[model samples]
Target: MSNPIMMYTEGLHTIPLEREGIRYFVSSNSENCKNGLKLHVEVQPKDSPSRALPNTQNVVAAEPTSPSGSAHYGHSVILSILLCVIVVLAY
Candidate 1:
């Protein structure tokens, strides 16, 4: 078996099921796993491949309206500090 890719970063869980004599492990995210056990395998509509859902908590939201003209001032200060650091390193 190859290295299993982690589906969930937290609350990792699995449910074992036998479909057509094939044992399979499904994630806790599935409806069957989410809500109690499903007695039989039901045909599901063809679904688009799943994509990783990003965590909103980790997403950095854009600064809600940077204080008017503060951007230029912030940039100038950062640049000045960077230049000073470079000069000090050079010496």
Candidate 2:
């Protein structure tokens, strides 16, 4: 309600949390963490989504893929197919 708490030591990000209690550290470099944003995501009474995660074991995160240096897929697939056809015909 007052201000968002610092969770991660790096990056400018905001996360909302509410619990029975929590603990945190205050330091000079970590001061910017205090300025992170806050959002309230509370479960409503008789909510269903809370049943999904208990031990949090049922969730798996898909890692973000780094972009390949070239536009590897969009054009190369067509070009390779055409080249293969040309090679077969020339033979």
Candidate 3:
């Protein structure tokens, strides 16, 4: 189960949770969250079996845009490779 409350931005969402007077913020998106950590979750206490501990995970905000917008370097490299292959095949 996940938290129902979330603050959504253009490419990310932030989920806030509080435990033992401490606040934790977890930032994630559909792309990064698939292979990475979850939004916000509670940790189990090792000392106390009856108490649930808070896992404080801070997610750094990523730069949503580059100089070329959402285009990545790998995409350009792949396109260049394809163009080279096409030219060589045509010759």
Candidate 4:
């Protein structure tokens, strides 16, 4: 399968992803993502609308919580994989 095209922009961005039999998208803003070290992940069904309507209740802020040791490790691994993906795709 071909990978999706991703454009690197200055503000909030959303990327669609599918795993196993599940479909979702992840949205993140570099400026608001802990200096690009973290992501503001949002998941929705494939049938749902990708863009949130203004003043709609579809958008919900994620609850803030401290990451455990394992969570930190997972985040690091994810970051590494993301970096590798970017490098490979850029070529």
The 10-residue segment of model 1 with minimum total lDDT is 16-25
Candidate 3 local lDDT, residue 52: 50
Off by over 4 Å in 1: 1-69
Please give the RMSD to the true structure for each candidate, in Å. 18.6, 12.5, 8.9, 17.0
TM-score of model number 3: 0.32
What's the TM-score of every candidate structure?
A: 0.25, 0.24, 0.32, 0.23
- Cα displacement (angstroms), candidate 3, residue 91, comes to 3.1
lDDT of 3 at 1: 21
Model 1 Cα lDDT, one tens digit per residue, 1-91: 1244434447645554433343334444566666664333554444455754555367678878656787659988999999999999999
* Candidate 4 structure lDDT: 0.57
The most accurate candidate by lDDT is: 3
* Runs off by more than 4 Å, candidate 2: 1-10, 17-57, 72-91
Q: Positional deviation of 7 in candidate 2, in angstroms?
A: 18
Q: In order, how many clashes per candidate?
A: 0, 0, 0, 0
Query: Model 3, 1-91: lDDT tens per residue?
Result: 2573445557654443334443334444555556564534465334674565588588899878547754558788899999999999999
Cand. 2 Cα-lDDT: 0.57
Q: What lDDT does each candidate get?
A: 0.57, 0.57, 0.59, 0.57
Task: Kindly list the per-residue Cα lDDT of model 4 for residues 54-75, writing each as its tens digit.
Answer: 6656678899987677975897
Candidate 1 is scored at a TM of: 0.25
What's the lDDT of the predicted structure labeled candidate 3? 0.59
